[model samples]
Target: MRYFIHLAYDGTAYSGWQVQPGVPTVQEALNTALSNVLRQSVRTQGSGRTDAGVHASHQVAHFEADFPPEMTLDLLRYRLNRALPPDVQVFRIHEVDERANARFSAEARTYEYFVRLRPDPFRRDQALYLDRGRPDVGAMNVAASYLVGQFDFTAFSKVKGAETHYICCLYEAGWHETAEGLVFRIRANRFVRGMVRLVVGTLLDVGRGKLTPLEFQQVLHRQQRIAASGAAPAKGLYLSRVEYPAGIVPAADVREPA
Candidate 1:
């Protein structure tokens, strides 16, 4: 049977979501935990890749397994958590259509980057601390506003990325203040490798008055990777949400932006 897992992980300890020959990874950890509980080898395909040190509050993966007699999903979740590393967790597991895929079936994905104004010991690993004068959130929002709608985001993507094309349809992108700090949230149909970090870096430049909002737009339209600023630190980024079609997941499982 095919099953979908709703999981989250602190990527601080992982090389990335995918497995590597010698490095530890979230996929390897999850596969091992599942195999141990099921008494057979099990593998999962995740919604997408997250670079090293990038966290995920909501991630989905699909795996095929022959659930043994008397096996319950709740029990399986409990056991998987026990077997998995402390930083990784399985929140929900449900049967999925045999054809449903965690990655290909996804309709949209949302990511958030957190910036803390002051140093906080507890969140040192999870946020970017800006020691300089506060950035102009108003200017940043103006720059971010340009991100909504379909565009070729080659400027924000990795130069050597494996994606065939750089076109993406963004539904929203904006920055707002939060209790923890300031956050930038962006939702898009899909994102190329390293896109969010690169975009965040450029937006921060705009916020700091290093680039005008129009210049930011021009950089994106220029389509030259060199025209953009460096990628922001991965520690501040999170794969906050993923949404799928109704046929792939129950209606309650899918989300709409506020």
Candidate 2:
């Protein structure tokens, strides 16, 4: 049977979501823990890859397992959590159709980057501290508006040979001031490597008066990586959500008895 695992992880201790050689990674840990609990080799495909030190609030992965009819998803979820490390967690599991892929089936993804104007020792690892001066929130929003439609994002992506097309349909893009900090949220049908971080960094530049909103739009049209600002720190970015079509998996309220 095929199962979809709902999970979240603190990226501080691991290299990234994907498996890497000779290093700790979220995928490696989850694979090992699932294998240990199932007593068989288990490999999973995540919805997407997050760079080192990037966190995820709601990520999904799918794996196939052949289990006795007596076994249940609740038992599997409980066992997987117990075997996994404290930083990595499996919250729920649902049996899905064989054709429901965790990555390719996703409809949209949302990401947020957090920034704090005041220095806070507690949030050093979760948010970026910008003490230079307050950025013009209005201008940043204006710049973000320019990114709300489809365009070539080569200026923001980090990988070169891996992508065949640079076009992405950005559904929403904007920044807002929260009580705790400044937050930038963007939703898109897809993203390229390092896309969100670079977008945030460049928007910060607009806030700081380094780049005008018009200049930012020009950068997008140029389709050159060097035309954009450097990517923001990985620690400040989070994969906040992933959306799929209705009926792709069982409803959240549906659960097997524990």
* Per-prediction CA RMSD (Å): 1.3, 3.1
User: Which lDDT tens digits does candidate 2 get at residues 136-237?
Assistant: 999999999999989999999895737888899999999888888798999999999999999999999999999999999999999999999998999988
Q: Pick the candidate with the highest TM-score.
A: 1
Measured by lDDT, the strongest candidate is 1
Candidate 2's C-alpha runs over 4 A off are 68-70, 159-161, 253-258
Worst 10-residue lDDT window for candidate 2 reads: 249-258
Models 1 onward score TM values of 0.97, 0.95
lDDT for each residue of candidate 1 in 90-109, tens digit (9 for 90 to 100): 98898999999999999999
RMSD of 1: 1.3
Give the RMSD in angstroms, all C-alphas superposed, for model 2: 3.1
| Candidate 2: residue 200 Cα off by (Å) | 0.5
How high a TM-score does candidate 1 get? Answer: 0.97
Model 1 residue 22 CA deviation (Å) reads: 0.6
Candidate 1 residue-pair clash tally: 0
